[model samples]
Target: MAKPKSGAKKTTPAGKAGAKPAAKKDNTARLDLIKNASKRVAKATTKLVKAVPEAAKVAKAAVKKAALPEKAPEEKAPKAAAAKAPEEKAPKAAAAKAPAAKKAAAPPAKTATAAAKAPAAKAAGGKASGKAGGAASAPVVPAADRPRPRATKLPPPGEPLTKREMEQLLTAGEGRGVTGEGSLKGRLVLVNDMPNLVVVGRDKRELTFLLQGPDQEVLPAYVDHKVSVSGLIRKTTNHGGVVDVRKYSAKKPEAEVVEVAPAETEPRLRYLSPGEVSMVTAAGMGAGIKGFASIRGNLEMTGEEFVLVVSNGGTRQQVSFLIEGKAASKGLRKHVGHTLQLQGVVDKTSGWGGRISAETVEPRPSEARAVSRDEMELVHIEGEVPTSVDVKLNHGLTVRLPEQPGFTWAIEPTVAKRVGLREANFEPGPNGGPATREFFFTPRNPGTFEVEFFLAKALTPGQVDRSFKINVTVKP
Candidate 1:
């Protein structure tokens, strides 16, 4: 009312114009307060954002410091643990290497003789087991399973020879040229359509005997009374091998010679004629006086006690006697060329050489037993005569080798006309030095044979010189 009087021109309610202005001012102040608060909040958010990185850096530094171990034991714990891990693995590794080390040392230790015992015993047992395995694995080769030849020329069954008779026959010769002589006394019998004389005794293979007389005489004697013949043991080169009577005496006590008629079933020894002998001059001898003797050139079968021929190299009448019941030998120098009279019984028909038994070998006043490896000085016991020899090669040649040799060789026939080997069959062990070889060979034909020896160049220079003396034994 007082304000309205002052103005007087316009009058308005107190709630209208003044109230509108107050409301506007209140709104403006409220807006200003809200704006100020928003500003403060924005400033606080900016400060917080700016401090976040510094806080994080401080936290990181604290974490790093906290992670570091302060004590020596604490710091060393991790390193110790790491070392222990390797140690744990190392034990297993060492355990594995232990066996390897033992294996490496085993070979040398086994050479100590004492350590070899167990292994050797195990090896022997293994060998025995292997033998058993081999026996089981081998295919049976029975008599029935054996291969039958298209033509088999086997001798017919004959009477058996006796042990006492064999002993007596084998023990008689002592002097030169079958001085020893022996005989078997027995009744004659017919076997497989063949006449044979036999004695009763048990010993050795081929106990059966054969007839030493003509078929007619042997047949009659076999059909009639008991017959006994006394003579030196003569090896006949027929029907594998057999002994024949070199000098025979037929009948009982007093002894009588029965005229025999030749027949088909007679033993070849019976009809064989006495071997011829000839004398020769100037001959050479082998290194030893009684070494192997042979003719200068190849000769056919003479069917005599010993063939006589002129010496090829030296000057001396050499006498060669085909001595029965003795092993043949090679490697001689002095006796190679010789010519002399042969004093030994021989079967001309069957090419046999004979020897008397030891009982029949009685030494004369001038003769004495010689026991020496070198007997070249013994004159009475040594003579020069042409001889026939069979060269023998070792059997077991084509076997796998355990180790390589310095030299190798092949065989060649230098002088032998009748060679007993095939090409690519065998290789000698070495050259010049001691050469040895076992060979398996297929014979060209079935017959009494001989072979010469030679060497071929199968090695290069720089290899040591090897010489091999092949000692061959011929089996009849």
Candidate 2:
């Protein structure tokens, strides 16, 4: 085969000789490996079986020992006797010490109990003390802390006095020099530059008292007549008594008195003729007379001077004059519309007006007549009649005539019929010293009618005397 070809080589038939030995060697190696493995397994199994039995035996012994009860050591009789002896004696010893322990705590408990009862005892003591002291034990409050008394309320201001009430107040002496919370019913008048409440006594004597206190503020408003002031009165030596006004009430005038006639010797004025006054006025000329010149006219105010409008028939002229003395301006207002007779000197003259230095100004007297019957006087009251006065057609017009010294006023029948005069009466003075007359008249129709007021002796019945003509214009 070696010589056969280098590439072709050797071949083996079925059941070749070296293949059987190689196979047998592999089988033997495999069987030896399996046997060695089997030996290892068998040895492991045997060791396991032995370990299980030993473990079981050791576990059984542990269980048996755990289940068995433990035995205590026996005690000697002398030690037990000693322990028993102490137990029997302990109660007596504790009993002996308990008193001391309680004694030590007793002071604190007593103190606590005393502290709790002390407040109650003190409260009881306080109640007893309060009862013993009565009102004295009550808390005393300071004057500043005490409740204040309520203030007294003053009465409301009074109503104004009527003309009728003013006459009655002046005549009545009810409230004169009354002191210590009293009231004075009268007309307030200014006397000697001071406020005075003028009242007439039962004897017809006029009494005047000074007005004082807070009422002074309102007293000025009611200068001539007003309310009845109530308060304390203090009498002085020289000046008169004063009233400390506290409250006031409204008053009205009542009850009339007869007016006296004017004096016969009263100065009569010389009025210039209508033609002469017109000619002088048209020429813008003045009389240039320095002596007394009596002029009749209405008084008017211009700036600080007083002017008089003199009318002669249809001719009118304005003359300026200065009032002498310290007369109040308010007193001049009453004569604004009334006719006045002026006595003055023509100091200067101008085209518009003339300046005059006035000595005296008086109310111009009107002509009067007497009536034969008991008929009322139809006095025509006009010009600056207060709007507050109620003027009705059927109602009588109450005219307050100025007080005269010695005269009786009467109405003419013819004049009364024209003015529808109904009644007439007299009232005491509003100024408290003189007497005044009130004439009541009813108008038949609204027209300008001339009525006459006659002045006669007090006892005379039918006598032709001084007649005062009044032009009455009735309004609807």
Candidate 3:
């Protein structure tokens, strides 16, 4: 009687255990489901997302209270069954397809989904997949939680492989962890948030690698440009690799270099002012005729324009004033190469040694004293020496300079005023000789004076070709 009762009690428990699958639709299983929901929601809120903690707490409390009667048996049963069920099936389906098919659940998703949608969905996905996997003929194993078969440990990376081994491995598609040195031709590209070398391998299959090196910065400049890379290469994935670049070069044309002209260094052009006119006039080498200076100086052709030679602050500062109006220059045109006092306005333009716009023209009053022929003294000039001369105060003076072709010898107007000029005569040189011009003058006062004559081109008067000076002493 005791044996049968014990047998019956054991039978009842076995029947109850087997009957739980049918009970999945029953009220007890439903309550257990509610408990599972409570746990998942609490984990999702408090542990995973940590969002809506209060709501999760309220839900857990309500579900826990609802599932109190069934929690002890129902909660422990599923977990125990999950643990024991895989052990039973793992040998039958020892070739686990779950590793690949369920690998998605293995890794963490890098980019998060919308928070409101992800937490509950994620909890449901993780918890539900285990249950669903157990039901399928594929056997139950959450890829992340599966006990992996012990693999044969590979040797530590030794020497780099040969080019032939690399070629064969690429063709075989089985070169999982081989290292080698080889040159690869490809277009540099950005992929998977990293710069990669993409090359077409055996059967036109594309191989990719995450590029790394000191020179990786130059990769962007070579994008879409054909490049050759040589270095240590290692196979990380079946068709992918990583290469620590030892060398790289681009098949690109040389960049063009442009030559820029040097910046302008010429000084700015400016006006020659009337203030300089005051210096010449104050020196008695010029005069201010009706408020216009330089009127007393000789009109000479400096270039194409009329210029008045005048002394300026004891320096060779030349002033050129252009005739601004045609009517203003009418009186001055006939006076080129002559000395006179003329009323004019001096204006400026480019490179006319000078031209004054005159309103009226006149012959200047001679300041030379009358001297008779008996008092005249003739002078001869020898080879460029003995430049000093002496004369009686009331006696006439003559100075001469040899003339040559293609150039003209003229007295510097300012220096000429030191020896008052009353007459000038050109004497033709003795038969077939160069001509000589005699400059006859008298000293207006008894003092030492310096005289100068210069040779210059007809077109460029601003430049002097050659000049000579003489010191003359006049004694009373």
On TM-score, the leading prediction is: 3
- The CA lDDT at 64 in model 3 is 36
The sequence of per-residue lDDT tens digits that candidate 1 reaches over residues 1-476 is 24556646775767785563433345555445444433433443344334334433433443344433122343234334333433343344335443544344333333322322333344335434444555555566666654422211323333444555445333323111222234555556566555455554333322234544333333444443456554333333211113244434455344577979766682333211222221111222122112112222111011212122222210011122232322211221122222222222332221111221111111113213222214222111011112343323322112111112322222333212233332221112233232232222322333454332222212121132432333222432
lDDT of 2 at 12: 72
Superposition error at 191 for model 1 (Å): 1.7
Q: Order of all candidates by TM-score, from best down to worst?
A: 3, 2, 1
Backbone-clash count (model 2) = 22
Q: Candidate 3 on 1-476: residue-level lDDT in tens?
A: 55675546454665576564542335564445444433433333333344334333433443434422222333334334433333333322323333332233222211221332455454344434433433443435665855423212333334666777777546537577877766677777877445687788777887886566666656767776677887777788788877777778877644768979989884443433476555434433343322344346544432234445432311233343433445435455555545566555553332323446666656565445345557366554543443888877767767666655534455656666667765544344555366565667777778898877666553234466888888888888
For model 2, the run of ten residues with the poorest summed lDDT: 311-320
Rank order (by lDDT, best first): 3, 2, 1
| Candidate 1 residue spans exceeding 4 A from truth | 1-180, 202-206, 213-219, 232-243, 246-476
lDDT by residue (1-476, candidate 2, tens digit) is: 24667788576776774574543234454445444433433443343334333433433443344432221122123223333333333333334443444344344434433433443344334434434444344466666754433223344444444454434434433433223445667788876545678755545666677777655655656776665877665444222366667867655555578889876882444444555454333324554423345556555443333445443111112233344433424566666545677665433344334555566767875323233324443334532243333344554565655534434455655666667654443344445444455566666577666656665533222443565565566766
User: Which lDDT values do the candidates have, in the order given?
Assistant: 0.32, 0.48, 0.53
Return the lDDT, model 2, position 196: 78
